[model samples]
Target: MPVIALLLLDGVPGPHVTTPGVCFGTAARCHPRVAYEVRLCAAPGFRSAGGPGAFGVTTPWGLDGLDTLAEGDTVVVAGHSGHPDGPPPGVVAALRSATARGCRIGAVGAGTFTLAATGLLDGRRASTAPGLAAELARRHPAVDVAPDGAVVVDGPFHTATGVLGGVDLFLRLITLDHGDAVAVETERQMFLELYEPGPDQGVRADAPLPGDALGPTLGWLEARLDRPLTLDDLAGHAGLTVRGLSRRFRAETGLPPLQYLLRARIQRAQRLLERGDEPVARIAARTGLGTPANLRHHFQRYTGTTPSVYRAAFRSLVTSLTPPREVPPPGPGGPPAR
Candidate 1:
């Protein structure tokens, strides 16, 4: 199994220490063939802080454990509470050494600061907790900071923002390692919506759809996915002019109004396709794509695969893993009693 070593610094947040294990562990359980040996490596006697209580976390490996990692392995720098303080020299040196050996590196939350300190993120687009983006940019001027991205991947370096950002980051990593099938199954088992970023977005996934001024409009659009909606309709629903709506919508959802609507429609079509054997034409109509040809065009553009192929791949993976449900025999006059 490939190793996913989570490098823990002192005062690391509790979730930062545990989320990787949960994510990769769940992925392994969901797809037995795709597994990772998750290791929590820290300096001697490092304990976590910033939750309701502090506790001793006994990690099996020390910083030197990073030396054992190879090209296919990964080292994730977990977030610490006192993030303003730079990481220790030993940790920085170990990370630099690991980079030299071609190990993929990632950082979660404030740990982006730690990775940035090593100059590995220099000239790379990285993300951190939204509130800390300015400080990260100020401290490491060479590192391009994308404050709004939930997860940002630049070459072999990956960075994620916020408390739940690790989940997104690890899922993305799993997708890269295994395939979308495994990652989608893992998401289903974990009850998480897979947040695949667009190609032009610099490998950046946006945070959850906002519940701000556009919330009502978004909800309305979702309810009426079967209807033809224009920019004017969305702007009118949101009580803004077309230009204002376009600007604000892009600012909030990271896509222009019509583009966001198209994405939403495609996503709904994806779910409908995965859940049942809905004919492509019906699925397209239900999602307001008008015709099967239009659906195929946009779906291919966004997902890089035709709708039927996507459905077949997803269903085949799911069906292979799931056992058939057993049904009780019927009685003479009626179905068997509960």
Candidate 2:
């Protein structure tokens, strides 16, 4: 239930004029119950993005800047920060003071440049929208920028890919604080399909994949998890080369062909574990994991537990149950330590 301060840096485009405002507003709606106390602040003498008649803004701290920033609070700067060469005098002073007081600061999109100017991003993995990725690295030698990600959370800082992908970043922060069950529902309730968390890239909905045939093949693969389909078979089915299939799968699902197939098997195993009490070997064979040992190899690698243990751990929801530890040890000599 900690409070967060989402400081709207001076000279940013009004939310009504940009997507950041839309994303933040929608996030507030979705997680109404989470204890997030968000406050918006503008430096002294700030007005709307358009010169003349901007909405009148006032703050407790006169244009003194960062004076209003509280220590140990989370600060989020949004939209384009009018200064790219470096942070404005007021912005720079405030960022330094806030960091000196141990505050966590972040920016959405180009705002990252401002954070970079503060030197807090030095040696940190931060990101901005795709276009600005190179500029951020070039301008600030200390920051380690990700080439393709909608958001990057390095240590205390949380950054976004700008106006369109800020919500994903915000919700990711929320998930780190709250949980994914809430994060998933929040995305489902408020965002476009592009905002989904699986892909760090904020790919637009209109973009095309490797080829038109890859789409149907992806859907076909998703629908037929019960079948033993290999990477070669998938490539053949899509009329794509193996390399082409790998690239397209990475583009579409943000995972390689074999990795995606492994996930599909795990997901299938999870469903079977939850719905029925079948032997691990049976579930493995049915889901194309081949054997219980193979299933445990991937299962433990991904979920940190074996199939029966996972089943027992999850099955406690519906009936008077036994915890995983009491389920009698895993079968003999089968990947002994798993």
Candidate 3:
């Protein structure tokens, strides 16, 4: 099995260690065939921070363990309280060596600063906690810091901000290793909504939307998803000309107005399919896809599965994980008691 080594440094935050553990553990339980070996590799004399109480953390592996990782394995640097001061001694070299051996490197929250200190993230796009974004950029001007991104994957370097952002990153990693089905199953088992990576490939969908200029217009568009909206309608709502709206919209969202609208419709359809028993025709109409056939074409094109199959697969996964409730043994009535 491929290994996932979480490098725990001094003053490591508790969640950084537990998030990956839970995420990968859940994925393993859901699909053992693609399970990865999760290792908590700590630095010498590592301790927990920002928890109920600080405590010593002993691990089977240390910083040197990073050298053992190879192509299929991954090493994630856990965020630490000393992140602003840069990585401790031997960390930068150990991480660099791991990168040389083709081990994929990742970081969570302030851990991005640790990875950045090694010069590996220089000239690469990354994200840290929103509050530390400016400091990270100031310290490492070569690194492109996208403060608004929940998670940013540039090449083999993956970085995420905050606790939930770490979960998103690991889920994405699971998706890449296994498949969408396994990832979705893991998400459901964890009682988390299915997460879809943004169209930009690296960022999550919750990243900042269009600027204030089109904020209200975007809300207006969302309120009218069931309507057959035209480009002119969007422009009029934004109080801008069609050409201007197209330019600003593309600049902010990286897609044309209609293209973005189609994606939004498809996403809404997905939510409806997952959360309700609505038929494909009804969902299609509600999402403004016009008909079940059109919905299937676009949904399959975008999500790689037909609407019915998608719904059945998700529902079946949920059913498999849910415990069966016991029924009362015919409470002295002709019909079974509810």
* Cα lDDT tens digits for candidate 3, 180-292: 75676577556533333344421111213334466787778877899999999999988899999999877766678888788778767877889999999999999999999
Span of 10 residues, lowest total lDDT, candidate 2: 200-209
Tens digits of per-residue lDDT, candidate 2, 90-174, equal 7767767777777777788778887888788899999887788888888987898988755788877888775433665776776
The TM-score measured for candidate 2 stands at 0.49
In angstroms, how far off is 132's CA in candidate 1? 0.5
Clash count per candidate: 0, 2, 0
TM-score of each: 0.58, 0.49, 0.58
Candidate 3 residue spans exceeding 4 A from truth: 52-55, 192-338
User: For residues 1-338, could you state the per-residue lDDT of candidate 1 as single tens digits?
Assistant: 89999998888877777788878887776443566999989854476555645676888899978989999999999888766878875988899998888999999989999999999999999999878999999999999999685689998898998455387789989989977756765665454333333444211121133446677788888889899899999888889999999998777666787887887787788889889888999999999999999999988887777888888877776676454666867769986678
Where model 2 places Cα greater than 4 Å from the true spot, the runs are 16-33, 50-72, 163-165, 192-338
lDDT of 2: 0.64
| 157 Cα displacement, candidate 3 (Å) | 0.5
